[model samples]
Target: MNNTHRQIAVIGGGLSGICSAYFLAAKGYEVAVIERRAHAAEEATFGNSGLLAPGAAMPLTLPGAFATFAGRFQEEPRVLLASGADFKRNRWMRQTRQAQQQRFAANKLRLTRLSAYGQELTRQLQEHYAMEHENSSGVFHLFRTPLEAARMASLQEGAQQCEVKHKTLDTAEIRLLEPAFSSEAALAGALYYPDDIAGNCVLFAKQMRNAAQELGVSFHFSSTVKSIQPEFGGRVALELESPHLDSRLTTDGVVLAAGMQTAELLRPLDTPLPMRALQSYSALVPVKNPDDAPNMALFDDSYKVAMTRLGNRIRITGLLGFMPPSQAIPPKALRNLLKIAGDYYPNAANYNQAHFWSSTIPILPNGMPLFGPTRHGNVFVNVGHGVTGWAAAVGSARVLADMVAGEKSAVDTEGFLPQDLAA
Candidate 1:
């Protein structure tokens, strides 16, 4: 290790990468960010559902998740099981099912702590910089059927055990929360984490990048990562190929956060990171009437869709899991989204000019990120955030940075460490 002058290289310049770079630079380490995209936040960080939800601590493979998976198969343009026999898809389901057992109870406890700590980190960032990314509080989950409502009540109990605050409401209360919902299907609701917020992930990343740059963090956009070579004494040599030229760079340590491509990059390194590149779609539609837009974020339990209002733009993002990325937005998924939107908020019917966006969620079977140091002396991993990547980015970055620096973190990261999942 270079004691006098330490150079750190981070691959992938999305939210996780940027957050890692920001914290490293703040700690006075020389930082270099190598991004393949023409711009930052161009991949998974682009146009997300925009929920900075801290209460999203429930594991995706809860006991009742099998039931939800059954629901997923029935829905067209489905959000689960992209394609059967897809190596990644099969592995994810198998691993996810395995994680549902009691042996992994500690994992869920750690996840809850990390998520809660993440919420505090987000609050501090907002206050420290006064960023403008549509940070709205008040998140509600609406259920259409009694069974659906009952399912949520059970999940709420789990959430409560995690120390997340929530309240159950009847049909009239649901109406007060979002009067636009006229369908008799919406009979009950749950509102929790009044402080849980929403915002554009891309916007927040850009803002953080700007701040990081001011602190002397160097960002190399449009540079594609070609290879990573293990150098002498816990150092790394990075080969980068760009449109302009091919070049090699060296650093004391490396952080891999290349989203779905991370698995491909590390394959040759003999690190089997089993991950599912679950594809998800989102649309930003022009709002014809301001009244029709939701003032707060709402999760439609029946449809597995999340809707939020970003000023004049109403963003609806859902539909996860799929094989070959859909060439374009699936019509069935889009129609279902609009239908749900209209069902909950009648004014949303006036929505027009919807722009479709899709991203590959790097899903781990445990539904938690394979975050923290790898077996390699100088290498670290920070991808596989799944749907909660946006929510966990900043906090996880802080945790990973602390591990690289050999410091103890405020939150317990034992279960989230890469070695635990590698087992």
Candidate 2:
């Protein structure tokens, strides 16, 4: 298929959409991106932990997950539940529980492969474009107790199967690797992935957008795509609701990469995607002491929190609360994140000057992202990446572009099909 004459429109200007446009343009297609925000990476891609750990890409539905969720009301809880459960939330929980019993291993493998591919593509882009976004290497998974470490046996198995290099380190070894770790804090052991990396997600996205533009991709910011309808000649028409633009635009194909809004857009096309939004929180603080700050990324397994060193700043993020959209940021979630920062690296950053952030992350029940054609012939989707969006975006976009170009994908596209997750 010759893509030189094709015009592709990508919905959403976040990391996924930007990468999609970049790959499509690289294939000799004329690409345009429609973003509701004024600029790229203004939403979920704005503030993330910046972790790109394929070795640590495990499924969320582990054994004894329900037992853990039962402690949502406890002090410094890792997971929070809504006071009132809606039908969508209830259905998501039910499916998640079912997946816990049936799909953990498969989902873990799927995520591991996709994340590994994405990390490679990310490094390729950085080296090829001479782009630097405060890139760092290594990831440490800290466990407070033996039981906490034991729960990751399945993840370790999956890592081995995926050939992801990792090591089980004792407390002394962990402290040697990261001497700034507090000795007073309880610690049993840690899993260290030396090949994993961390970088500034927003900076990387903006740089990639520039690279895409170099390939002749146009970006239409503050342009909201209200609806998508298939045209008579196999093209797709998009209804726009931008203050500065015309009402409609038609293109050869449309890719839906909008987080949370992807499902809403698919509904009018009669494609039902089973996805739920999870509210997550993060805090960015200026590093007060460089020697005391971590050299790489750290994940506290017991608390389900991540602390990442991004240039001169430290981003502490955690908490997956199934709550209402109108609800304010929960005080308990903020306290838990602060507690982790203080417990592990109290002198590393200016805690009082931390900037708090919250965003809704769309996730599938099986903890795997969907990226492929939908029921509509010319419409494709690249959404539901959850918190692993940074780790999986590039690979998903590459695969999406391959599918759209009628070419064979570099990676196996078994469970990533949009119809595989349809309700």
Q: Which candidate has the top score in TM-score?
A: 2
Q: How far is candidate 1 from the true structure (C-alpha RMSD, Å)?
A: 3.0
How would you encode candidate 1's per-residue C-alpha lDDT over 1-423 as one tens digit per residue?
Answer: 233446788898998899888887887888888898888888888746777775644454422335545664355433544434555455567677788555345565566667777778877876799887676777777665565566564556556776777777665775676665454554555555566677777888899898789879888888988878887667788888866644988779888988877777777788778776767777778777666566778776555577877877778875564546766766666676676677667666355567776787777777776677676767777886654456677788988777777777887786677788756
Whole-model lDDT values for every prediction: 0.71, 0.81
Q: In candidate 1, which residue ranges exceed 4 Å CA deviation?
A: 1-5, 60-88, 101-108, 143-163, 187-189, 243-246
Candidate 1, residue 269: lDDT: 83
lDDT of 1: 0.71
Model 2 Cα lDDT, one tens digit per residue, 1-423 = 235439999999999999999999998889999999999998778755688889766555422335446763377665666775467666677788788568777777788888999999999999999997787888888887676676577778878987899888776787898899877777777789999888788888999999999999999998999899997778888999987778999888989999888999999888978778777788899999999998978877666577889879899875677766544678877787888899989899999898887877787887778899998868989987755457788899999999888899878888889767643
Mark the 10 consecutive residues where model 2 has the least summed lDDT: 59-68
Best by lDDT: 2
